[model samples]
Target chain A: MTAAAPTDRTRLRRAHERGHHDRATIDAILDATPQCAVGYTIDGAPYVTPTLHWREGDHVYWHGSSASRALRACDRAEVCLTVSILDGFVLARSGFHHSVNSRSVMLFGTAFKVTDPAEKEARLTAFIDGLFPGRTGMLRPNTEQEIKSTTILGLEIAETSAKVRSGPPKDDEEDYELPIWAGVIPVAMQAGDPIRDTRNRDGVELPAHLRGWRWPG
Target chain B: MTAAAPTDRTRLRRAHERGHHDRATIDAILDATPQCAVGYTIDGAPYVTPTLHWREGDHVYWHGSSASRALRACDRAEVCLTVSILDGFVLARSGFHHSVNSRSVMLFGTAFKVTDPAEKEARLTAFIDGLFPGRTGMLRPNTEQEIKSTTILGLEIAETSAKVRSGPPKDDEEDYELPIWAGVIPVAMQAGDPIRDTRNRDGVELPAHLRGWRWPG
Candidate 1:
């Protein structure tokens, strides 16, 4: 695990309840979800593009079309990447104080575009295998033109902080006397029935791992 | 329903998909989630703050401490407010193309601070009732000091677009010959057992709606 970057911006709120700046906690949250809303600015206007991401050690990687202006603006620029999991709703007696129990990580760093053809291919391969392990070797590798048309950016974990609010809701002391009810309505990600494409060719069987995969707890 | 603000940015990728831009789709996604990550920048530094929000007509409202820099920066400044709901994971043949089926709304508009005391109070009440229907009438109203310490901002839905990807994963046509599995793992939010606060008074029964609240489909 990489040591958390030391900076005032990286410090957790209520340090005691911060659950520590552990790399495992950060990695778990990143791996639990497949998508993130990448927030960046172009000409002082804020724009957010949701894209699939994967983590390798302390760095996160995402790819977009080479022609994407948002991706072009993000290359080598300071970016704020966030991934959040809505665990449950925290209902409280006081309406103003109601909150949600969630786990999220905000990473602030400058993204370095992968321009090396070999490195880009390897990173893109690792990204795919990260989400669907053991499948990289079976598919045809990206052609040179394909590699040139995709822009991959890697953001180092600098000045990153995780803010998690968990457990039950905390209502105001005075509002405890009110007759309203308060508790969590938990949210979860569950696997549904799989639908195979009609264009699937003959003699293909779904892998056991994919057929029985469950969301990490 | 108010007509969607006309702009090249608000246009849908497929014209047929433009019909989903009506008020019903926007309101349904907004009302489903109470929290949103409001993205803005101060002096070119990007910041994303999570806050509770409510929608009325073609506008969205969010409040924070009067001293909040993000809120103050948003006043009269162009802002990008996004709401995303992750429905399932897209398991594609290539990891680079792995994605999630999600619904997200991005709106670009100038925000105006709500300083009128009476209108601020009304917005606060609407925020509460929007999440927990009928509860605002049962609780005591906000005090003058509480109202004064908070600033509410409204962003008109000037230029808005909704992007949604659902159903099974879309793998490359040629990759279908590979033996790898490809399908979606559905995700959902489920209710949990309620935990009564230790300080609760006697004879307070949970409301009927609270007992069986469900996430909209």
Candidate 2:
């Protein structure tokens, strides 16, 4: 895949070595995580809301209550969707060099509500199956009113940038000899063991997908 | 001691029950998360950049390279800082009710660079001590050159709102009786064992505070 063209909006001014404008890198970061923070403005005031996001090829989608003000502002304005996964905390011999190991993406685009009933239903089904494979068939299908109450926003991936930081902290040359215990404390955002619903149907097996899906360490 | 006034900007348009404006709740969420996504506009284009954030009282600060375009644009423009912690995944019997148990804060205010030499140094020191406890004395002090290359933006908490979703997913009354396995898969972003730097100074101990500072489970 070709690298995304670096428009004025997507260029990095510092640590340019960590910046990547390639679709491959951006797509990888988006796929690894399901949560994102969306930034949008209303009457000149900016707001960032954390929401669940998923990608299908070059398009990304997120949904919310149809009555959400943040989503409403997002649909009517240019939005920035950012996804970041914190891998670890970097400790350096010098205070100045401390950082974090992370992979993140910033995608700039506009979002619009997914309004078609059939399309929304299919997308919502994809969401369920995306999280728990083959489980959508097990649960009742979305009701017509349920589809109407949800707002799914789709943004074509354009002007995107991905940044990655990994490995040990880079302390100043002289400070490396200092006696501070410097290293990284790995941060794992893991999904713990599932708690079956108190009212769950008796003997329903935990699906394999739910049992296996975990954030990459 | 008083609640933040709910204005047109901070009011929730949906699920008003989940909205909170008290400074105590807002401060609690900010204290727990180390990362935040900042939203700001430059020439009518919106951008969201994730960076490390810390709080001291009602004021919050985040830093980046002084040459960063995003930070430069942020210093002059209005900004929004948002922090979110996903506590668990809510699996409801109905797809429409599926949500995540999370604590999030959206703080809106204009950001200005912490330009004073002594003030910036103190705040940066606070950031280090705040995260690592009594480690600043162990690490090499920052050189003046290092201070010159960093830009820290401070935003006083003026208009902020906190939204929380916890407990089990609130399924429709009828769907709860369905045969679907519905419950929460608890998610935690925790620190793992520290990996010593390959070139660490001999016998430097891992400070006790570093081992103990963890988010409430």
Candidate 3:
């Protein structure tokens, strides 16, 4: 896979060693996490909203109520969508060297509203099935009213950068010798057993796809 | 625990039912998660960056290399700090009703640079000890140069709001009778075994505070 060169805005000014411009690294981080924080401007001040995100090919998409002011502001606006996964906590001997093991991707683009009815519906279904494959086919189709009330926003995955820090702490050369317990407490998002909704139909069973799905998959 | 009235910027324009203005809910969400995305504008374009965050009293703090351009842009600038935790995937009978159980807090304020030398040092120490209590005294003290090379940014926790969604999927009344599997797959950040740094001295052991520290504590 070809790696895209970082634009001036996406370039890492510090800790350039942790910066990754390759699509493989960037796509992996994007695919690993379903939640993302979207940054968009209204008038002039910035607002960050946490929203579920999904990727399809080179475009990333998020949806919300059509009445959402933040979503309306994000339409056609230059937005920054960031997905971050906390991998671990890095403990070091010195306060300055304390860090986190994380993988994050930041994409800069104009968030174009998915106006085509067919495209919006397809993307929304892709999002659902993307997380729970084949589950969409079993679920009731989206009603026309439901589709109308939702606003789907999409951004091309261009001008992107991924930053990752893994393994252990990198303390100053001398601090490594201190009599301190310096290491990492690996952290990951784990999915518990599937919970059946109280209102489920009598014979419904937890589907096979969901049983096989795992967090950070 | 007084609930602050939502400001224009912090108000939840949609789904006000899930909106929380009380300090208890806001603080709980903020404290429950250490990773946050800070949204700030540069040249009127929004930029969101993930960073580790900690709270003290009525303020929140995050620090990074003094040479970071994003940190420099955040200083004295109006910024939005957001923390989000994905609790579960809310699978519903319809794609439109699908949602994620999440707890998120968004705080908006001017990101003030910590200029006081003593305050900076104390806050940095509090951050380390905040996550891992008593670990500061156990480790090598921060050198003067380390302090000089770190830029700490803080924001008062006044203008804040939290949005949380839990429980099973909230599908339409009629849709509940559908044969689809509707439920929540609980998700949480779980910590694995602590991996000690290879360079640790012979007698170093995983400290009590760390072993007892749980993720999402």
lDDT of each: 0.73, 0.84, 0.89
Give candidates' CA RMSD values in order: 3.2, 1.8, 1.2
* Model 1: residues with Cα > 4 Å off, grouped in runs: A2-8, A11-24, A138-140, B2-24, B94-97, B169-180
How are the candidates ranked when ordered by DockQ, highest leading? 3, 2, 1
Off by over 4 Å in 2: B212-217
Query: How many residue pairs clash in all the candidates, one count each?
Result: 1, 0, 0
Q: What residue pairs clash in candidate 1, if any at all?
A: A128-B95
Q: Which number leads on lDDT?
A: 3
Expressed as tens digits, the lDDT of each residue in A1-217 for candidate 1 is: 7658555545653434844466777778888876676878877777776676888877899987797776888898878888877777776776556667788877888888989999999888887666556666765566788789899998987677776788776776777777766767676666666666555556666765566666654
Identify the runs in model 3 with alpha carbons over 4 angstroms from their true place.
Answer: none
Q: Per-residue error at B71 for model 3, in Å? A: 1.3
Q: Report clash pairs, candidate 3.
A: none
TM-score of 3: 0.97
Question: On a 0 to 100 scale, what is the lDDT of residue A152 in model 3?
Answer: 93
Model 2, range A88-169, lDDT digits (tens) per residue? 8898888789999999999888787888999998888877677667767767678888889889999989878888999999
| Ranking 2 against 3 by TM-score, winner | 3
lDDT measured at residue B8 in model 2 versus the true structure, 0 to 100: 76
